[model samples]
Target: MRIVSVRTWALAVFGIVASYASLYWVQANTVDGITPPLVGNLPSIVIQGIGVAVMVYVVAQLGLRQPIGRQWAWLTAGSASFWIGSIVWAYYEVVLEQPVPFPGLPDLFYLALYPLAAIGLFSAVSAFGKLFDTRVPLALAAAVSAVATGAVYFAVFRTIAADAQLSAIEKIISFFYPLGDIWLLLFPAAALALTAGQLRGGRLAWPWWIVVLGYLMVAAADVMFTVGTWDDTYQSGSIIDTGWWLGFSAVAVAASLMLDVQRPRDTGEVAS
Candidate 1:
């Protein structure tokens, strides 16, 4: 009756908890209304930061091999690029356009922090995927996520931002703003869950599948919401929209942690 290390288990548990807590904070503070203050939202951002850190530490210790490392590097580099774009968008959205409290430090921090975190997450995912020989699927998923995010940026976000009526230099950034975010939140979440299953030496845990399904569901919901709001101001119907994204993200993090806890320690060979 072997048991998992307490530290490993705790990291997984707290990572999920912190992720959800951050989501709740965003729901409570940011999505309820427009003109949300960046200063006020700092705590939630901090919580997310904590969760990402714990997740990186846990996955890094899981013993991934070299090929996976290279692929993960690509993912990390792409995510960082996406987040840099996001920081630019945020500056335009919060600091430039809307007057928010404590503008200077918070703005600068978020701008820098997102890309850094993206690199960390990419490292974690690469290491985690090394626990199994499922590189093809993992690579395919990363590619698809990248393509989808890119499509959204070029086709939808850029056009909307470029409109003369709504035009701002920041809007040009709208295209890539959420691209890294979608990849970071989706692929890494799924990768962690799959890694957990492989580490556990069990029949592939269904939680990974659930995470993918939830992502699809949330994506569908976003599409529906977009259609419904076509005639209305995009900002008005955002509470539910943002809440749904955060909720699914929390669920993904929690499920991944649970799977990680249930995984067994490595024998000499990788677990099938």
Candidate 2:
């Protein structure tokens, strides 16, 4: 069990490092002095996929020995899965298809990915929500927000199909996309806060606050970029976009390390 835990941690660390390296390569090799839109996005997705795989392995290791470990393992693995889906969607939407390109078969796949990611994220929140008494409300809010966002996005899609010049769908999709992100933000923040509280109680685990902080930073950067470029082409050169991805990748690595460190000991003890 100890060996397995160590192996998982090693894999997580490797995944983090590898992801960052790939991202760095993408940034360094910008085409025509402009960061290729897809370049920035694709590496992140690949890295995240690697991170998710590592997390699943780690979770499996923990679950083998402890019952409660199974719950935490699932939560982490589930979140990773969602992250992977989001990464894939981003790759297809932002990287693969862009610049007046209508979403094709890939778009269908991309759209499907969002809901799956949403479900995985929700499941993770539910599994760990007890940490915060507000889990129920947060979960409900997230669900409602997701549905609302989806409906608005769908409406825009319909309008776009009906009349290419109609900006109503674009307007609606733009207005509510951030609202959808808000749901993503809430539950993770709640979970981190709960984990922080546990740390305060003398839990010797890797601080959940680290992951929380990283996630919040990423979310904030995303919001800023979304608003900043709302009226312009979604370019990747802005300090906010590039810097955000770099910071996000770094934080993800840190979070993976923290998870590795927090892996429960053989005594079956876990941070509450």
Candidate 3:
């Protein structure tokens, strides 16, 4: 099957984001009390559902027998976990007409997504283990990680950590999210940096970069969600959610383009 042009996918992604944003506005601004129950809960479910479908389809197309195939397979599972978490989120917000419980079942699935995807990423990076020159690449990664960790700590963890009203469990749950994103972010970044030489100006680079960008979107959305919730301004279908829709859509498109990124083009050293 022929994949569509990147521009086409980009347009489609933008269209989805626009649709989500529109739905969110409708949900937020109810007329005659019509939208608060139904429309309020649809955006996250719809966007995440599409992402999981794309991920599952991509893995199936790539075949599970191969190594990178297995990598995306796990990634698909991670996406599914997040999708399920959204369902639980919508269930409380729309179905039950109650506040969704924090540090709850949904939190379990949401937290699970990071480590699961991290496993997939770790698998992919492990494939290129021999190519790694531990000195320079490792040092660079560590330095960059230090900066990222510090930024996230100040921007996210610090607030959650200092929340006097939260229970010990609540604080722990809140802390888990940004830390999870840190885990998820490290993989694609490391893969890009480590494989840059082999991928030098190659077709494979873009998809990986897109994957990284998708996670950055997810990470950003997570931070925004945390702040919003901290300030009691967050709702499921808010504008901040556009980042998640865009992130998931971008990852799906990247997965579709993985025909090139599943492996390098010319280099034979990095096995699978």
Q: For residue 101, what is the lDDT in candidate 2?
A: 28
TM-score of each: 0.45, 0.53, 0.83
Supply the TM-score for candidate 2: 0.53
Number of clashing pairs, model 1? 1
Write model 3 residue lDDT over 1-272, tens digit each, in one string.
Answer: 22345433654565376656766576557765455745666777776787778678768867889987898888788878988998988888777888888768888888888888888877766766666543564466667666877998887777778879878887776666766776565545555545654654545556666777777788788888777777777776666677777777777767766743553342122222
Provide the lDDT at 159 for model 1: 52
For model 3, the superposed segments whose C-alpha errors exceed 4 Å read: 1-35, 132-135, 193-197, 260-272
Q: Where does the lowest 10-residue lDDT sum fall in candidate 2?
A: 101-110
**Clash number for candidate 2:** 1
The model with the greater TM-score, 1 or 2, is 2
**Residue-by-residue lDDT tens digits, candidate 1, 144-188:** 787877766665665565556543533433332344346645666
Candidate-wise lDDT, in order = 0.45, 0.47, 0.70
List the pairs of residues colliding in candidate 3. none
**TM-score leader:** 3
